[model samples]
Target: MASLNVYSALVVLFFTRAAAMATKENDQIIKDNNCETKMGLPCVLEAFTSIFKTGTISSKCCGELVGFGKVCHTTLVKRTLENPLFKDLSPARIIVKSIQTWNICLALIDSPSPSA
Candidate 1:
């Protein structure tokens, strides 16, 4: 029926608009995170390699982690959890230990120093 076609067209238009909005939103988040200029894909990949091996996150990488807003942080965590590489690497255990270590580093940076 014509009404059914109209409904289908509206649904498609709504979804297309939604997808464009989502893309723009994600672009903004990426910009806020300085992903292109600061957190390049190659750099993050390299840092993660070292992190997984020695459980030592470089200061640069740590800064990037702390820079992320809560939503971005949770999104990254979820994606990392879902990655097959993490499963092979036993990511949960590594993340627990790493969090403990990174916390110390993060705490120092987060704290304000006394001014003379």
Candidate 2:
């Protein structure tokens, strides 16, 4: 029983360290890419809501999100999933949503707008 407890503790420690490393790497990627400033606050909120909840992203926000670049978008989503507040959320589902959101935004941005 004691050995089992020790092994469990070691496993927990390893995961903790791995999570910390992942967070640090994510932070570095965000910083390096200047991701925080890529989109306006409203657009960020729209993107977050679109991915994390039942919300639609406006065409304007979709343009901004597409400009934000896929690297930044993906890294930010992954970081958010790592947060304990989102612990109950399914990572697979969230990832799928994120991809869908990206694709939708990309399509919206790529399509030619109608002339007045």
Residue 65 lDDT in model 2? Answer: 95
lDDT of 2 by residue, 1-116 (tens): 99999999999999999999999999999999999999999999999999999899999999999999999999999999999999999999999999999999998889999999
Look at candidate 2 and tell me the lDDT of residue 49. Answer: 97
Model 2 gets an lDDT of 0.96
- Per-model TM-score versus the true fold: 0.45, 0.95
The most accurate candidate by TM-score is 2
lDDT of 1 by residue, 1-116 (tens): 99999999999999979756765666667667655455556546644554466545556666665654344543344445555666677767656654664574477558776799
Best by lDDT: 2
lDDT of 2 at 87: 100
Q: lDDT scores for all predictions?
A: 0.59, 0.96
Lowest-lDDT window of 10 residues in candidate 2? 104-113
